[model samples]
Target chain A: MTLPKTRWRRRSAARPDEILDAALTAFIEAGFDAARMDDIAARAGISKAGVYLYFGSKEALLRALIDREIAPIATLLAGFAETGGADPEGTLHLMATVAIERLSDPRFFAVPRLIIAISGRFPDIADYYRTEIVERAIAALSSLIAKGVAQGVFRPVDPVLAVRAVVGPVLFAALWRHVLRGDTDVPPARVIEGQIDLLLNGLKP
Target chain B: MTLPKTRWRRRSAARPDEILDAALTAFIEAGFDAARMDDIAARAGISKAGVYLYFGSKEALLRALIDREIAPIATLLAGFAETGGADPEGTLHLMATVAIERLSDPRFFAVPRLIIAISGRFPDIADYYRTEIVERAIAALSSLIAKGVAQGVFRPVDPVLAVRAVVGPVLFAALWRHVLRGDTDVPPARVIEGQIDLLLNGLKP
Candidate 1:
């Protein structure tokens, strides 16, 4: 006997990954405040109830999105950390290359824009970002700097401050290019190389 | 007939400076989103109508707040620019000192917070900030760096990138400490000096 087609049946059988992918696209297009559950469901070709079943609410979905996006970056850096920090310049170049490559992905820019857009209304989300994503990134960079200092490869520097200086410029450059200037074609690698060179060589007579 | 004592009369007579001072405090305390015109008027001991009489809307008040707060800073830097990059180290120390001093001011922190908060909600406000404030500051710093290099007082560097590296760390450090970390006691001067040192002397061994 053939079964009758229903929205619930379609939703129940839908993949979680497909739902998340659709939700991300919806969130990017309309922002968190404007994005509706129905839109996400529509994008996923599932029922609205199915989205709620998978991700409790819109806020939960956003949290899940952030986690899903940041996890891979953290993992990649974790792997880089295992190699130690004998070469400061090479390590920085590698990190910058990887960072630029990741940032080229649409999700990277979209996630931050989403956060900044909703940060005022949802302070907790911003707080989570600071503690989870920013602090973790800083800690990773700090450990690498400390390792480099111990090896006497890089100059003895305050690891925390040094990490801030190195990472801050790259992040702001991307922000300026993508968010402010709306110039995605500007090569992130060139900007990163210029910044790395500036950091390595002081503007001194 | 003798003049009748009225709250409206008293509020109407209040000075523009006093109203702005109160608005700044209110904006800082509750932020742009939560702050009310009535509260600002009450803080200034004026009526809400009196507050509106001077500034047409909440956004206009914010724009005025930014203008009033940053004008003095622009004036101070104007004096620095007039010196024509004679002493690079001295000029840097002076600029760093001014940044540290401004960070110490509650108004400096509050104004930016309000702007950031409002900018998230209003795209035009953010556009005004990018064009008027951020770009202008970058231009001034870039010109100073170019002059310094041409005067043979500093190393030949990409002035634009160098200025960004030199300024970004200091600005973010203040934002991190005050806004994010909420640590008022953190000495900004020491941090600024350290950043200046880092910029003058590269991190290479």
Candidate 2:
């Protein structure tokens, strides 16, 4: 028996990435509850049925987007201590650098905005972010700071608070860029550099 | 013509403040678009006409809210130097404490969230904030930092960037509490203290 194969199968198979990209825009522009699947499909040049075929539902699509696009950069925190950088200051600086680079991408920044905008209506997004991104980053950064304090390379500071100190500024820069455009947000890279410079000094013994 | 004898006139004369208070709660709960004038009136225990008599329109109400509620704290930065703190570190610490104390009020924090959430759809709110609040705060904070640097109390860093370094984290903390409340945002007071502690060292000459 010969299957009646068409170009649609191959096209639909490749549609997830494009659909996800469109979904990001849709989610940002319209927000979560107001975002329509058809709009996303239309933006991606795919059919409604194809979107459903690939993502199954909106929740699945969001989860897929987070896992595929966001979780990797966020998970960079997990391997941070295992990575290169001999000095703790250098290591923390590296983390700031990586965060700035990763979050500079509008796509990455959009996810958090979507999470912030939607988390009110959808409580799980908060938990998802807290567990998936914030907790991991805090854990990794805290470990690095703890090492620095132990090695006498850095002054003693609450590792958790110190990590929040670092993350808060970086996250703020990203949030400004994500939420409002124009002259509102200072360049994220500049903020990152400034934050790391302050940290390098502030964490000194 | 004889004026109609009614208690409504007396009530409506007292309407603006109560209406503004109710407006804050309504705006926070339902957001700007979804929030209804009737709900605000009901919440204020005033007639709908009383709200209109006082504020005129929603835009006018918002402007009054900013002028009455947010603009005052923003203007507080203007007199910061004239205030009773002796040293620059103490001055900056004072500023941080004042910021934390003032912003910890849910009413104040809610204004920023409403502005951030609705600014995309309503550009005026952003401009209103930029002028009436943000620019004021920045200008004041910049002056404070510049004075510290000149007096040899703080290192010479770009006051603008330094002001940002101060504000970004504070704003982030406030935003977390405003946008996604749970265990996510560190209490504003703790962030303020930690930030000031770091600033004390980082800005030391």
Candidate 3:
């Protein structure tokens, strides 16, 4: 029973993640329009039928990438809420750190890159990305800023713009990594923290 | 003499510009790899020979786009130098304004988009954009920030990161306009101005 249970747990944990890793490579190499599931399965060391067992189609694979890679955005926001009341600014700082850390991770960077790369050709992909990921993250950051303004801890500023100000540099860093990566001397963390520092100091009344 | 000279001047001015516009459309539709010179020439209402007269090859056409479209970047820096001594902060503010205006122009928007879109597949294009445009702009912004910090106009900060902090948001906004068009409620001007305002305020001692 113990041996069988171990085998089952390992299989469940590894299979889906392996397929996703393969999918990122395929998508980046050939793009969404040209990436094939059969090729993805081959790269993942699985049969086409096995890939289908996990993801119904190429679209589902993309959605799962969003769900799995980007799920951190909502989770981080919710987690911060429990302790957010203790210190409004602290909550923002933590969120900034998390955003830079998560966004700059190469494993998850593909999702945003894929969305931006195809954005010009496919309006629907951009819309879905905004609805599923970007807008939700913006809403969470906006609410955090609004709370600060309401409590009189931070100066009155446009929360939406402030959220954009905070998040934009890190987002830009993430995209720039894939675009002009070797050209930049500034490390990802430095770019994120430097941008956040200036913005945070400016936020103080 | 006047009639012949006028006819020649109009043809010379219009033909190159028309070819560049058609090149932009072709690049966006098919990317750098698949885009054909013949197709671009057809779109521009010219013969392939006409295009080759102005541009030697496909690579030369792209280089011409960079020269014609992105040349403003360096020129703007030179324009700011005359008044930079009188007002360093204002210099940056004006540059920010110019950046937003220039980048948002649809004709120019496609240049950066084409650069970013194929950055992974074509490293040289990204390098060309970074070296030719980004580095020059950063140098101008960095010098301005250094002068401000030295002259007691701004709080001391890492000048490189400061320049990046200033440029990153507006650049992001320009890119965002194309990627998430029709979805944003905040006007483009507001997004760029708000982010700039926060950073400017933060720069104060």
Candidate 4:
């Protein structure tokens, strides 16, 4: 009983993730509009029916892919926002480090790249992404910055704009590395450190 | 003689720009590979043969489009770097203001957004863009930063990383407003001011 139940649970839990991975590969290789359910199913080593059983449509698969990949990061940011009130500066440093590390990975960056590509054609997809992921992340970061301002550790700045400054560099680094395929002699960690330093200390002596 | 020469020059010079604008619209509507020369020619109110007479192929058209749109911005950055050594801080402020104002326009932002979309499949195009535009811009900005540091105006920092810090937020704002279609209640000018403030003045109270 124990062996059978353990095996069943593992297989059931992993199937959705496997399908999502296959969907992402298919979407990347073929644009979202052109990617076929059959290709995704073949990539997953499953039947098309099986793919449909898991995700009702291609759009659903994309939404799920975004959720699976981005939801954890959002959760982590929320956690920081909740508990890092005492040391907003330190927390921001940690957040930047973690974000750069994760966003540097091509796999993690792919969904956002895909979103950027198709957003012009599919406004709904863009809106969905903004509401589900970006707004949440920005809100969490803004709350943390607000906390810092409240505690008098940081200068009085609009948290909304501050969130953009904090996030813009990290997003740019990811775009530079992945989308542009630029050569990176400087390690991402160092890039993150440099950005955070400039962000916190500025260039003025 | 003067009328004929002036008319001829205007028709010839403006034809290329008109064709390039049509090409951009066609490319945006259809992904680069799928876009048709006929569509571009038709959009430009010319025959396909006319388009071929001017630009040989879709790839050539893309290259020309990039050059027509982006070369001026690169030139502007170089100009600033050359004459802006005396007042680096003021120049940076002016640069950011100009960059944000230009980049905020959807038409101006279109090329970079298009590049990001297709760069995965077209590494050569990406390379061409980086060498022709991004590298040149970064070099110019780095020289300005180095000049500032030499003048004892700015803190000692690696100019390359510093360039990233300076360019990243402006790029991000463009992406957010255009690619993501995020609603912007605050004017782009204010956003640029806030980012510049954060960069020049540390968050330390």
Candidate 5:
């Protein structure tokens, strides 16, 4: 009974993740409107039926991909919270660094582009993006800003607005570099550092 | 002779402009892929062949739309340049104010959204957008930053990064208010002022 249970657990864990990985690549390249399930299965070296067994449909597959990728970002925010928000700059720096690092990882970068690429065709996906990813991120950063303000380390700024100020430029730059421009030579770390500095001192004040 | 000349001039100018306006609306709503020439012609209250007589094809119509709508943004930048780079903050403030004011004009708002929506499907359009709109804006902002740095008004920040820092938040907020969130209650001017203030002062700096 123990041997059978161990084998079942091991088999289920690896195959679904593999299918998701293939699905992400296919979705990014061909877009949701054009991507075929058969291609995803072929890329994953599995049957079309097998891919469906993991995710009931392509939409479900996208949801799963989003869920898998976003979990780590949530975890990172949680870890930042646990530190009592002692260093706002440090926390922000870490967030930027992690985001930049993860963007280089093929699985992570494909998710947002996949969302943007399909968003017009399926408006529901855009709503999912706002609720699942964008709102969560804003909430986490808002809390961090509130913590810093309470500690008297930060100014009395609207946390939501502050979070936007802190993260907006970095995210936009990353989007331009990685997705729009496809220029890999520009180091994300340098861009993050410059952005963080601008945020810290601001344009004038 | 005067009567015949006046009739021809009125026929050429008014009809084409009306057709362009209708095409802009239909393109914005339906996007390039889904927009039909017949629908545009019907919207313009002209024959389908008449629409072709002016623009030749759907692609040609889009090209004409881009020229009519986006050329003004370039003209605005050129006007700003002609004023001389005296005050960075003042110039930027003026630009923001004018941009927000122009949001009341549906053509100003809808045309860009149309381009963003359709650019992914048509690579040529995307290339034109990158080359014509985005690159020009970046160059203009970069020039402004360089001028500011030279005059000892702004810190000697990286011009590219500074432009991103200044523009990204404002653009995101505007897009959210107008396109995504549709919260027109909060005036665009107020949002622009807050963003400008944020840029001038760092969160921690």
Candidate 6:
């Protein structure tokens, strides 16, 4: 097959990131199944063979994308969980703030959207995402909440349920902003701060 | 075109509901753009013409399904908001319970899932859902929260963010149960109650 002219461009350290970026755009625009490697290569300014050299298959690219984009967040959450035991509330606020900032960006939010959209057709992708990104994040958050409970700063609530409370609004905000394309008059940071305040302080006068 | 053998069944008052049920299944199984009217009719035990007679197009069928399945819930929420001024906390509890109960069901949750999946490809569908279902629900819930604040039962939180707090966990639960297919160790009602308690009481000792 004839290679695109841009394929002659020299490879650099940023090749993987460029390819993944292109893959994300292709997947979002054309869907995972319909997105072709040729298009992804062209978008990345590489040859199809170069794309394949980096990612053996489309699924591998997705997995790498998840790792590249979401895994670091999960790792950061874990780091916070470990370091935040002495001050869970403050750590939780920091965590939520970071999460809201990241998710508010449509490019960062696209992975979960892609997973949610295609999960029914590809259970394995859903399973991978749940295990790799979602479950790890929940586990880290749960540990932080559990630390708060242990310290007697917070009430004894089930960590699982508490994690949901912590994550739900953040997730919803992302969905509202990205998926539904709702207009957000309030800045994302402000919205998240409000949510965190409500969680920590309750609605009682 | 030859009609499917099952098309001869007599039309009943339930025909519309049947067609909608079939349409939902078809749409979920095959992405909205890929789902065929012929398959929907066959699934509903009606002819293609019969399907078209009731619904002019696939988009129409989707709209009708949303009305049939989700509109009443919005109406119910509005009713609660109207009557809930006297007891905002109690009414909020009742509302969350109702939402959790309905969303826990996969069949009931499918519409939102479908919308989230296809909104990128079909902006009009997304807009229709936002205006018809999500916005209405948020408005009703926000009004209820405002009543709570007016009565001093709730702190003066911004009704918009407050609505997100109220909705986030419940929506997350549905996504957890249906999309990720997470195993629910705690029952949904209990989970919702825990979240509501966390919201109203805060996490403090």
Tens digits of per-residue lDDT for model 3 on A1-205?
4455442233656899999989988877776666788899989877788899888878778778878778767667756844686677778778877877776676677777766666766677677777767777777878888888888876788887677677767766665666776445766656667676777665223
Ranking by TM-score: 6, 4, 2, 3, 1, 5
On residues B125-149, what C-alpha lDDT tens digit does candidate 6 reach at each position? 8898899889998999999899889
Better structure of 2 and 3 per DockQ: 3
Candidate 6 lDDT at B109 equals: 86
* Per-candidate alpha-carbon RMSD to the true structure: 4.6, 5.3, 5.9, 5.3, 6.3, 3.7
Residue-wise lDDT of candidate 2 within B1-205, one digit each (tens)?
A: 9776874446645678889999988876766655789999999987787688778788677778888888888877667855623465676767777876676677887676666655555677667777778778877877877777777777777676667667766765665565556464556667678777775565222
CAPRI tier for the interface of model 5: acceptable
TM-score of each: 0.80, 0.82, 0.81, 0.89, 0.79, 0.90
Candidate 5 residue-wise lDDT, B103-182, digit = tens:
54656766655554445456686577667766776777778778888888888888888878766676566455434443
Which has the better TM-score: candidate 1, or candidate 5?
1
For model 1, what is the error of residue A73's alpha carbon versus the real structure, in angstroms, after optimal superposition? Answer: 1.7
Cα lDDT tens digits for candidate 1, B69-97: 87567657656755747776777678767
Q: Which pairs of residues collide in candidate 4?
A: none
Docking class of 6: medium
Q: Model 4, residue B199: displacement in angstroms?
A: 0.8
For all candidates, state DockQ relative to the true structure. 0.34, 0.29, 0.31, 0.53, 0.30, 0.66
Off by over 4 Å in 4: A1-15, A30-38, A47-53, B1-15, B30-38, B47-50
Model 1, position A5: C-alpha lDDT score: 75
Clashing pairs in 6: none
Which stretches in model 1 have alpha-carbon errors above 4 Å?
A1-61, A100-107, A110-127, A182-186, B1-5, B10-52, B104-107, B113-121, B182-186
- The residue-by-residue lDDT of candidate 4 on A35-95, one tens digit each, is 7899988888777988888889888898898888987898898888888889999999888
Off by over 4 Å in 3: A1-17, A30-38, A46-60, A81-83, A182-192, A203-205, B1-16, B29-38, B46-60, B182-187, B203-205
- Decoy 4 TM-score against native: 0.89
True lDDT of residue B110, candidate 6:
79
Docking class of 4: medium
Give the per-residue lDDT of model 3 (tens digit) for B1-205: 4455442233666888899889988877766655788999999877888888887888777878988888777667756854585688677778888788787787787777766656666688778877787778777888888888878777777786677677777766775677766355676666667776778665223
Candidate 5 pairs with clashing backbones: A200-B205, A201-B202, A202-B202, A204-B200
